[model samples]
Target chain A: MQKVVRMDDMNGVASGFPKTAGAQAVVEITDLSLVYQTADHPVTALANVNLTINKGDFVSFIGPSGCGKTTLMRVVADLEHPTAGTALVNGGSPEQARRDRAYGYVFQAPTLYPWRSVARNVMLPLEIMGLPKADQRERARAALELVGLTGFERKYPWQLSGGMQQRVSIARALSFDPDLLLMDEPFGALDEITRDRLNDELLSLWKKTHKTVIFVTHSISEAVYLSTKIVIMSARPGRIIDIIDSPLPRDRSAETRDSQAFLDVAHRVRQGLLAGHGKDD
Target chain B: MARMIRPPAILTRALPLLFVLAVLAVAWLGGAVWLNAPQIIDRWQRDGKTDYSTGELVTAAWSQERPLLPAPQQIYADLAKSFSGRLDSPRNLLFHTWVTGSAMASGFGLGVLLGGILALGIVHVRTLEKSLMPWVIASQTVPILAIAPMIVVVLGNIGLTGLLPKAVIAMYLCFFPITIGLVKGLRSPDPLQLDLMRTYSASPIQLFWKLRWPAAMPFLFTSLKVAISIALVGAIVGELPTGAQAGLGARLLAGSYYGQTIQIWSALVVSAVLGMGLVGLIGLVERITLRYQAVPKAAGGRG
Candidate 1:
């Protein structure tokens, strides 16, 4: 079913962001590696990962478990430090971009404050940013409307279903509208039907705002279905294995899934994942 | 099919309570007969009275000037009389209750505030939680009643008299639970939310006011309920050894010195009411504040 696409989606999300994110690179990483120091042993979460995400790109990072897709997103979001090489967001260090509020991150879990209503959850970032109460309320309403949750603004997070709670978190991430949007397996926990529906809504959102999105997922079909560009990573000393350029049309749908070109990209992703698992054994 | 023979809902609840009250009344009467019987018999023989029956002896046991255990009605009558009299009357339990209530409320208020401050420190600083939590718990282990005289004496010497001294004792009793509950509550936010806060690059104070503090509300109220009850106990204990002036504790002391068992019982009942009122007040506030977040499900797990 076609979800209602709002005229002004995620009002706060695009406020100060470059409208078209269409010129130059939004994210640039070169030979990036991360080593997590544990007491027993140092484990490499990501190694020698190189990529460039342009403005308005919907890039999906797909790999087997233990691959550093999440770690890469965290690097871009400035949540974790890389051990080697350089990662730049909006042409500056990740720390600098984070301070600039250049990006918003959505975790795998909904991460909505249970005590807060849906609108209040969306208002959290704006509250931290010290926006006026009136502006915060306005932006929250617009963001919730973008996610088709206008009527449920006053409902607490627990009162909503899992999918609705996830949408609320999406509204929250976009409440402050940043140039970059990082999602780490946001729909991984949802059932197939809900996931498909959300995938369509997300694509429509991306289409509307043209925000630079870095989505991480395990499903091959999901990556092929949503991404303009697909990044495949390998496990065990996690490293970028291949970068596949998706030939799927911009408006990829159920028909796109049955299309030969879409199947070609999905098969390639599956093979890339199988190769990563092969190295594991 | 035959319909189920379920009792009416009101009857189902009230019947059990009525039965329990009946059993307690019967046991209390039997105890009165057993203990007061000796005295009534002694008087009968001493007066050379003749033809005293079991029924006469039972009726005689009911109205002693100072019975070993006063009947429930005797205590109730004393409470009614004490409550009905003038506000300034020394015999009035309600006035004594107010004297205690002032100290309890003040101490409870101060304790909750201090505990919240200490909890904020404990939650933010890792070393503080390790260093201070042990001491906070240890302070409770040293019974407040045992230390009440010392606190009152030291404060009294320093010119901290009356309500202030009793309030200090209440604070000593009240703060531990608030501190512990708040610490647990402040740290209760899911790790994912913490990471989200980090992503926002939110300042420590911002994080506290928005995330940590609000999340800690339910736990704070729960702890406050417990603390308020104990705070009343602390107020009474503070009054026990200090000057014996104008509190339920003082009333109890006066009654004990003058051999007024009925007076002591009335004081005890009034204090119980005060504790319940304080806890009920907290519960009402909790309901009002947390009204939005109530989910209709039984909490299936502890912690």
Candidate 2:
């Protein structure tokens, strides 16, 4: 993997978003397991998987629906706890990290508050964390502008198109200046044209911010195009099959997906996914 | 590209309201003529059965009044007199009876507070929702008339005679719609929105104040409009059992007892207008709040 070691060199990732501290592994999962207790049975969602995410790296987890990519993301964000083993953020437990406001998570849906204007929705995390009002406003405005939603601060979520709303969610995730961003199929709901545009925008934002990101997606091409490291997982009680390092250059563009190097990485990811498909059966 | 980016237009919406007003004017004019013809001929026959002259006919048409369908002109004149302080003069028919106004105001206020609290409780607690929701529906199913006397007599015996009794009646009828609307509104947040909040480690208080409260604004206003109308009905019914007060409801009862049709009709009209005005006030607030949520269709911009 082409490691981005210097925070000062990570410019143009986001408009006014601070670079990560870059000295530590921000997220670490050690043999994590997750189970959901239903009425009739307890379903194990994830099993004994270990991974480490360093600061400022763009990493992605790619697998099928039942592969626990989203489950792992949820565990890392402390939205859900692992049934066994443990996960840590910046040397503390996920719960402590959540209390310290260590990360921001964006879902497949935009999920912007319908009543709030785009700017206010972006400011939600800051307000909840009880930041100074002036700082919240400044960060919100900068985040909106970064997402190319500069003129849409006063507009409600429903008034914006789906792609715009997703961008607003991204802007919201960046507004709080969290060290890590956990995204679960953030662009899955968008159409092809919008998805392509957003992928480019997300890459640009990642490059500028240098915030360590763990993105979850099922698309092989998308995984290869965006991430420095791609973790492939097996379905049904998901365990990590392989974590491959991409050879693509750090400075990416729309044409990066079409390049021979990108194609080779995507091919490997697809084969890994296919091989890991029947582990449950 | 031009088709996709259409220019702003206001003409389309205005056309429908214009058509509706025209239709209403036509219907009113036709009804006015039909109502006047019978009374005019009867007046001519009763005054010695002579063939009416043009002047006499015109006078009769203008002057004739029917008990069932009172002339719009007469209602208008009465409305004008009431507003102009002629009717409200102490010597005149419509004095500013503090008794009636006080009772109505108190009753409506009590109803709103009761309904609001019940809704909040129901929204926050599931057990209360399961227990109370069905009973609320069942309460509305029974005729308000059947319940009105029981309320007045029971409360009157308990010495809760004036404000509390009347307010209880109003609340009894008004609470259901408000509770249902508010519950739906409070639960209106999208699943993803809830997850986003959860990711932030937001407490229930934070989630509600930041997300649920604002989302419920539109629904709350809608229920308020419905509740206001019911509150007026409850207040009027509360006045019916005791005609001792100087309210429009007491006026209505007095008119019915003495066979004074015009007085009853005037009181009815007043009640309608008051109810409409109350709902309108809430609607005005709704408009202001929703404008912040609404995007002007003409100015299509991206977020």
If scored against the real structure, what TM-score would every candidate get? Answer: 0.90, 0.83
Docking class of 1: medium
Q: For residues B10-56, what per-residue lDDT tens digits would candidate 2 score against the true structure?
A: 55567788899788766754565566667667766798776767666
lDDT of 2: 0.78
Candidate 1's residue-wise lDDT over B3-35, tens digit each? 999888789879999999999999988888888
What's the DockQ for every one of the candidates? 0.58, 0.48
lDDT of 2 at A48: 81
Question: Model 2: per-residue lDDT, tens digit, A1-281?
Answer: 12222222332131123434544677767667999999999888899877777788899999988888988888888888898877878878888988877888888888877767888999999999899999999999999988999989888887889999999998999998888998999999889888888889889989888889899998887889899889998877788888776789989987887899998988888888888985555
Best by TM-score: 1
Give per-residue CA lDDT, model 1, range A27-106, as digits (tens): 87876899999999999999877677778889999988888899899999888899987887887899999888889999
Q: lDDT at A49 for candidate 1?
A: 72
TM-score of chain B of each: 0.90, 0.80
